[model samples]
Structures are given as C-alpha cells and as structure tokens.
Target: MTIIIMLVAALLPAVLLWLYVWKKDPQKEPTSWLVKATLLGVALCIPVAILEMGIETVLFGVDGGPTNLADTTIMAFFVAAIPEESFKLLALWLILRKNPFFDEHFDGIVYAVCIGLGFAAMENVLYVFNDEEWVTVAIGRALLAVPGHYAFAILMGFYFSIYRFVDKSPKIAVCILLVPVLAHGIYDSLAMSSIVDPSIGGISVLVLIYFCVKMHKVARKKLLALKEVDKCDNESSFT
Candidate 1:
C-alpha cells in the first residue's frame, strides 16, 4: 500500500504536466517518438546519477561534511546541474536528431517536456521511497520539484527550437544546453542552501516559487509564438 501510494504520488504530476504540454502543441508529434524520448530520459538518469556521484566524491571527498554556501553552489551547478542537464540534452538530441516527425517548432517543447517528466518520474520515485517522511516529501515534490523540471525543460525546448529552426547557429545550440543548466543550478542551490540555514532557505523557497511562475509564463508565451510562426510557415508553404 505504501509502495502503491508512492508510485502514484511520484507519477501523477509527471503525467499531468506531460498532458498539459502535449495539448499546447498545435500539431502533435508521433506517439512512438514521444514514448521513445521518455524511455530514453528514464535511461539517462542512471548515467547522470553515476556521473554526479563521481563528481561529488571528487569535490567533497568521500566523507561529506556540513555544506556551506560555496559548497552548495558548487554542488548545485557543477555536480548536479551540469551533469544532469547535459545528459538530458544529449538524450534529447539522440532521440530526435534524425527523426522526421520533429518538423514543427512546438514539437521541441513537447518532446523536451516528455523527456524532462520522464526523468522527474524516476527521480521522484527514488526520493519518495527512500525517505521516512514519504508523504511530506511526495506532496512537496509534486508541487515544486516536478513542475520545476517542467519549467526547465520548457526553457530548454524554447531555446532549442530557436536553435534548430531559426538561428541554426552553434552558439544558439549551446544556449539550448546552458540555459536550462543555469536555471536548474540556481534552483538546486537555493534548495540546498536551506539545509545550512533555514531562514535563508525560507527566502529561497519564495524566490524559487516566483521564478518558477515567471518561467512558466515566459515558456508558455514562447510556445504560443512558435505555434503562430509554424502556422505562418505552413500557410506560406502551401501558397
């Protein structure tokens, strides 16, 4: 029963977020490709975990100590954000690079969100099941962490679409990878800081919430703009 609850709590937000992003696309991607991207995302977590452990070991030594602000920032950006987002981007590229269905601009967001949610689902299960206070952790993650992943993916896809369809520049493609890493790093840094200082942590949470909300709005607007551009391109192609 506890395991069942854990699975449901872990997956519910991911499914809901997936559906929301899917519906935002004016022209949907192939179901098969989306499924593959998601499965790839799940698989990517294994490597990301291994890489992060190795990095953490190098940075903090085998025996971890109390985290200071410097340690938290370093862990957040280099250890967590860099490894995780870099691999996720690699997974995204592998899944969609040669696929014909990746035609529309909005498809980038759709597929990226799918991969992001896949990672979130796997990650949520691990955290929720491992913790003693499973319910509190589950609920908090459902609200913040899952949505946070979605926001990060949205930013990734937004820049990625521009890189793929608009600019096609190496710099823009690099931005596709870096933007999300920066966002994820700041997010984790703030969350990790609370471990050392609860007062500062409280402020971090509020700021995170605000940042997430703003990011979601910006991402949504970008999606809509891309959809419009796609529409124009389709009409022009016909004429």
Candidate 2:
C-alpha cells in the first residue's frame, strides 16, 4: 500500500498537468498520437539518464552534486537543462514535423506537454525509489519538480509552434530549444543552490516559490493564447 501510494504520488501530477494542457487545445490531437508522444518521452529516459550521468561524472566527479553556486549553475544548465530539453525538442521535431494532426498552433504545446509529463511521471518514480524518505520526496516533487517540467514544456511548445507555423528561420527556430533550456536551467540552479548552500536556503526557497508562481501564471496565459490563436486560424480559414 505504501508503494502504491508512492507510485500514485509520483504519477498523479503528470497526469493532471497533461490533461490540463490537453484540455486547452481547441482541436485536440488524436489520443493515440498523444500517447505516442508521451511514450516517446518515457523511451527517452534511457538515453537522457545515461547522458546526464556521464556528463556529471566527467565534468563534476562521480555522483558529486554541486558544491557551490557556480557548480550548481553549471550542473543545472549542462547536466540537466541542456540535454533534457534538447532531447525533448529533437523528439518533438522528429515526431511532429510530418504529422497531420499537428496542424494548429496549440498542437505543439499539447504534444510537448504530453511528452514532458510522461517523462516526469517515470522520473518521479525513480526519485521516490531511491530516496529513504520517499513520502517527502514524492510530495515535494509532485508539487514542484513535476510542475517545473510542465512549465518548461509549455515554454518549449509555445516557441515550437511559432517556429513551426510562423517562421522557420534560424533565429525563431532556436527558441524552441533555447527558451526551455534557459527556464529549466534557472529553476534547477535555484533549487540546487538551496541544497548546496544551506546558508541561503531559505532565500532560495522564497525565490523558487516566487518564480514558480510567476512561471505557472505565464504558462497558463500562454496556453490561453494558443487557444485564441487556434480560433483566429479557424476564422481565417473560412474568410
């Protein structure tokens, strides 16, 4: 029963967030396509895990987390944000470039979010399994970490749609990968700093709280904007 609870705690956030983003899409992609995107995220865990660990070992030493602000920032940006978002963007591109269902501005957001949540669900479970105080870890992750991924996904997909349907130039194209990497790096740096430097941990937590609230609000607005964009696209089609 404890295991069951832990599993639920680990996964529920992803499911809820995925559903929230899916609901925001005016023209929902088929369920199977969405599932494929999600499963692709799950599938990506193997490669992402290996790459992250290898980078950390080579760059920072074996299993050694950040020791200071600089270390934390480096690990966050390189080990966590860059590779994760790159793989996600690559997956999004490979899957959706030729997809018929990926027709609207919002579809990018939907598929990207589905993939993010899928990765979050499995990653959360891994965290719970490894931690001694899994209840705390699970609860903390469900509240913050999973949502962080959700926010990053929204950022990625927002730019992804623009890059895909609006402009394909090198500048606009990079935003799909760059925006999410920056956001994820910032969030991870802040969060990791709290752990690495307990002296200012309180300050770090306060800032994280502020950042998360602001980020979620922005993510919501972006999704709402996508809905409006779909409406505009539809109206233009008939006119």
Which digits, one per residue and each the tens of the lDDT, describe model 2 over residues 57-170? Answer: 998787676788999999999999999999988888877988988888898889889888888888998999899999899888988999999999998899899888888899
Task: Please provide TM-scores, in order, for all candidate models, with all chains considered together.
Answer: 0.95, 0.96
Q: What lDDT score goes with residue 219 in model 1?
A: 71
Candidate 2 versus the native: TM-score? 0.96
lDDT of 1 by residue, 1-239 (tens): 87897899989999999998888778888888889988887888888999988898998898983378888989999998989888888888887799899888888888889899999999998899899999999999998888888988988888888988889888897889888998899888877888877779778889888877787787778778888899999899999
Output the lDDT of residue 124, model 2: 90
Clashes within 3 Å, all models in order: 0, 0
Flag regions of model 2 displaced more than 4 Å.
Answer: none
